[model samples]
Target: MTDHNQAIRDDIAFMRSLAEAGRQAPLKGGSILMAAGLIYAACAFATWFAASYPVSPLFMPTLWFGGTGLFFVALFALRRRMGAKTETNRAAGLIWAGAGWALFVIVLSLMLMGYRANGWWIMAAICPIVLATYGAAWTVAGILTQAGWMRGVGFGAFAMALVCAWYGLEVRTLFLIYGVSLLGLVALPGYLAMRQAQRAAA
Candidate 1:
């Protein structure tokens, strides 16, 4: 009976240690966001130029689809380089992944809607929607990690969404704003998160 009680205590202590370790470990997978931000920002700028100038209509679709392809390639590479994962990292990854899928589905639906309606203005809504999705993702991460800065990022995303919407009439300007926003909101934060994770691991 004494042995049995001691064994139970040992299990409890081990579980507690794991929980503590996870709590201390920094979040991972920031590289994915960083890559996504940079790639899409360039895509946005290119699209803006395409719209402004007398570029081929094929340019816009090619640029965005190609940018997405590059993002996925980077995604795979970053995932492999992330090394071992912790519970917190796994949770954070899941949150971001779901957000990504949600955005994909939304974009596809909007595309379909544009095709059916024979009007592309509906596509303009994608800008605010994307930012809103990011806001939700960042907010969830903040809640999970108990990080105040992450929540602030979430708020910033929401605000940016409004800004994008306000400038929605000027499609060219909107793309420029979106590219800048991605750099400030997504790329910078992603870099910071990567640095923090590295420091924590060290």
Candidate 2:
């Protein structure tokens, strides 16, 4: 069988084991937050569409959008807090890796200023550098929690980075699309899938 099919089977087996062990408790918190993200995306798109004005995804929206993601992160922590355990070390690895990326962002913002020749170049680099750092975190987190779905997300991020380099979009446009599309599109769904998988295992 192809590796993809094998991986799916393994994931299924893991879920079955969880179910058999009665660890499966539905995590509605993650689901509710994801649904909220979709709702917000729909509202944003509609608002932008009706107004005939492009909405710049700004800092406030980022805080709200990022807060939604943080909600899921809390769900993961809560699950573990409530006695959930990962058979693989991937979860722990991913957590530490996430921390690494957060630190990288702080450092990068401080250091990269004035280092790059053009302001647009700096903007383009931000997405990829952040995402690559994030991928590095997932890589260190352990392989089980780090799956192909995440690889795809990383690639999406890398693609965004390339686009940033090629097109040099305004920071506002980049923020809007990245938050509404990348996080909303890639990170949010990946988070939901993880939660769903955990739920099924329960």
Candidate 3:
């Protein structure tokens, strides 16, 4: 009986240590997310301005493509600076990366469909989809970290998606609102993550 109790205690202690280590692991790739949010925010703003005030036919697409390109460049640079990742960070990174790829494929497909359909009404759906994707990502992160604030942010993102859809009839309004949403949903959380990582390193 004594030996069995000791074994059970050792197993519990081992699980506790694993949980503690996971809690302490700092999430990396915040800078990449922050840069993506800021870059796309600028793109959305520029596209809004172009729509409000007429610009060259090629201007909006060019701006968006350039912004995406810039983000990739920034991603490469920031990723190189990152040190070795813990299992926690690796899991978080995979989730975000998958979300990013999903968004990329969805957005491009929408763009192509819009072009083929010869109607841009489909473009209005992009903001809501983007926000919802962010919501899912944040929700998963919250589950992994067991953080209430992250979960709140995730639910808040879902609400924001509905808000964007409500105002999505107008391209200009949608772009403006989405830019703000990116600031709050993507940029702010990313900044907070960066701060947390910095403090952890310290």
Q: Among these predicted structures, which one has the highest TM-score?
A: 3
* Tens-digit per-residue lDDT, 1-202, candidate 3: 9999999999888655544555777567778878988999999888788887867867867897899899999999999998888766777789999999999999899889989999778878889999999999888776666566777878988999999899888888889999998988888888888888888888
- Number of backbone clashes in candidate 1: 0
lDDT tens per residue, model 1, 72-141: 9999999999999876667778889999999999988998998899987788888899989999888877
Question: Clashes in model 1: which pairs?
Answer: none
- lDDT score for candidate 1 against the true structure: 0.85
Candidate 3, run of 10 with poorest lDDT: 14-23
Which residue pairs clash within candidate 2?
24-202, 93-141, 94-141
Give Cα-based local distance difference scores for all models. Answer: 0.85, 0.48, 0.84
Task: Give residue 152's error in model 3 in angstroms.
Answer: 1.6
- Decreasing lDDT order of the candidates: 1, 3, 2
After superposition, candidate 2 runs with Cα above 4 Å error: 1-82, 90-108, 111-124, 136-146, 184-186
Cα error of candidate 3 at position 51, Å: 1.6
lDDT assessment of candidate 3: 0.84
Off by over 4 Å in 3: 1-21
